[model samples]
Target: MSHRESDRRQFLKKSAATAAAVSVPYFLTGQNAAAADEQKANESNDRPIVGCIGTGSRWHAVGPNAMQLGDVAAVCDVDANHAAGAKKKVTEIQSKKGSDRQVDVYEDYQKILDRKDIEIVTIVTTDHWHSKIAIEAMKAGKDVYCEKPLTLTIDEGKKICQVAKETGRVFQVGTQQRSEMGLRFLQAVALVRNGRIGEVQNIAVAIGGAPACNSIPVVDVPSGLNWEKWLGQAPLVDYRWAKNGNTVNTRCHYEFRWWYEYSGGKLTDWGAHHVDIAQWAIGQSEDGMGPRSIEPIYAKHPVDFKDGMPVQDDRYNTATQFHIKATFGDGVVMDIKDSHQDELGFDNGIMFMGTEGRFLVNRGKIVGAPVDALKENPLPENAIAEIYGGSMPARGNAHMANFFEAVKTRKLPISDVFTHHRALTTCHLSNIAIRLNRSLKWDPQTEQILGDDQANAMQSRDARKGYEVTV
Candidate 1:
């Protein structure tokens, strides 16, 4: 073995053996005796030594899938208490399997990366911190399983794609919709391409947008939590909960999704899933290609980012309503979302209304007019199109298992970053249009929004210092 590999082996041997003698929790001492042995054994047997970086409520739910996929060697979080909660679940798994794998815990994720034995790192941190740790973990030579909307800025997405390619590391973005089922639902899409849909006219999506945030009072950082690390790449503003002023206490945990500084809100949250389906439904995975033009007209209610800062308002800043018409080079019109009605509509899916017939697809179902058509004599086969699967992946429980499986095989998972970037590009444009409040034409080949300097600016975010996204 090379010197580096030899040192890694020695470190595992000593840490595991020595840690066993110390009866303290692994996070406190940075290693547990039994876990060190598990790490060494996993190495000899070729099983991946897995470590998770976030242990919030979401991780509590997603942990079992990863354990089923590989050996759970360690867990980390900014909060010690949260870490303990997650560590308990992992310990239970270890106990159930009767596998003596010790799960070391750490308040800081850097300690996990410092270990050369960890092969795959699952990052479920806040939206703002996703790219920061993901890029760093990949740099540390670990495969990354990052949650979606894997970037806080367009620049971050670009950097993540670049880093994955540069480091030769396998990276999977957790979009999850594309891998839910046995069938990909592409045959129907092939029919659409074969003109069975007959000259696609206008396509409409009805997903919602993120609300804007206003000024709120700063609160004390919780005890035993690494607030600075939590805010690693975000602005160094005082701590403010993502909830409204009166509800700030209710929003203390996991509600970080609604803040613009931390995330793009629904624009990225659900958009990552639905826009991905929309792109696949329309075959827009190829990054260099996108809508030729876009026009984001304000709905009756729109979030205004005046002076490039959020106004301190109690009402949410996310766009409750807005419309943007996307035009493709082939004269295909795709309406990403329609805000025509509020009571009930296709609010979270992609609908393609073609001349042949109107087809609609959502998470729960994919049904359309002439609904029985695919079942009928079906459209004649086309040499150009591959067979289309009938539906999106079932994300009820199997999402993370698929990710770990891909890691071991060194293959790109269904929700790989390359495909996600295109989908996110579309979703980001809607925000661009809404923020700029005007018509914008885009050059897909050029990857530029035409004519409006202000609209084009929203393509990237102002990353905080020490966390600027660079390729």
Candidate 2:
């Protein structure tokens, strides 16, 4: 082992020893553990050592949330600045808790995965890197907490599900709307599932459009960044960036979301969150249930496209304006659109219209006829809990804590991979429909596109040599 690995192992050993004496290291030391029995108490008394992969702007939030539940022993990112910033944050968190633990920094995520001391890893990498890193982490015997839109393609989701089942790792996709948001989402789901919204005739999800960016200028790779490594699994391309006042637009970092090469634009960005809830509330998140057909009614991309592939590489290629219709096997029509409906009067939210009543829900509020009627007739006490697999509604950062608790019980978290893959499959199909500018027949049971070979081929991408995702 290298000197850094040697020190990490030694520090972990010492930290484990300290935890044994200072306090019982139950998987949950927070309010969630108040009702545990002695056997449960001893199940995972040693706090799990965690390693954070991809400490970018998103990691600033995810890393701190996870620190509330586990020890962050190490952080890794391709950019030296990100890794250094994450290490500093981890040290500050540990220090505030009265522990003077030193946080190790790494340029390669494989180093974090190779360390046996790390029991959990939070993957906040870009959309394309999520699958490869998560599969490797599970194979290395570590549970994973990965960010949203977990898979870049349909087949990648299948691969992740296969690995998750085979390894029996407790994985949590960071779709916090299921576990947080003041329990409004949970309540909305409960309302729909309990017939509060009647038969659910139609659902409309408005997840705003992607921004059109001017052609970003090709620039020299900045120091402390591994441009080649950062593009793992993605095609080798020139590093591009340009400055506009206080904002820097680039084909790297946060701007990667706007490029189809790295992400699916709003289809997967906000769609990952809103569409997941729409399907969840409609009770179509099961493995063999999903939209039967997706039609791209209207779509406008920033670049020209032929054969569903962007023609130019100098600009953002994802669809900027879209209105897609997803028809489920149950005759439920879900409209995923970019603009707000004047009737609904909200720019971003889910509106379920049903036989008897209707309601609207977003991060801000859950309102409408059915929600308003709750004043006179409230939902059952255990209604939302039942929808959430018996866990009471928890607010703020509970997603990470739920993952740690699952580490002890081996149960799936509120946002498990199975449901997430189903939701993401809908988003992926919608993107494909827009790219092809046509309608698609889907077989949710077989997870295939019916009679469309080219569309079926888009289900998976050939990774660049040396970066293919391995079992």
Question: Relative to the unseen true structure, what is the C-alpha lDDT of residue 225 in candidate 1, on a scale of 0 to 100?
Answer: 78
**Superposition-based RMSD of candidate 1 using all C-alpha atoms, in angstroms:** 12.8
Question: Residue by residue across 78-167, what tens digits does model 2's lDDT show?
Answer: 999999989988998779867677799999899999999999999999999999999999999999999998989999999999999999
Q: Against the true structure, candidate 1 has what lDDT? A: 0.65
- Candidate 1 local lDDT, 1-471, one digit each (tens): 764345334433543342233212111112242344335545667667788999887776567666655677889998888899888889998788667888899987889999988888888888778887888899999988888888776666777878887887877787766544423334444555555666567777777754444555566777877777677666665665445445552123465776566776676787787666666555555556567777775542334577444564333455555677777655667766533333235566667677677666666666665445768756565311222121122233335544554565565555677667767877777666666566678776566777877777777777677767555
lDDT of 1 at 152: 70
Clashing pairs in 2: 25-45
Q: Candidate 1, which segments miss by more than 4 Å at Cα?
A: 1-45, 181-196, 209-217, 241-252, 299-304, 313-316, 338-345, 378-398
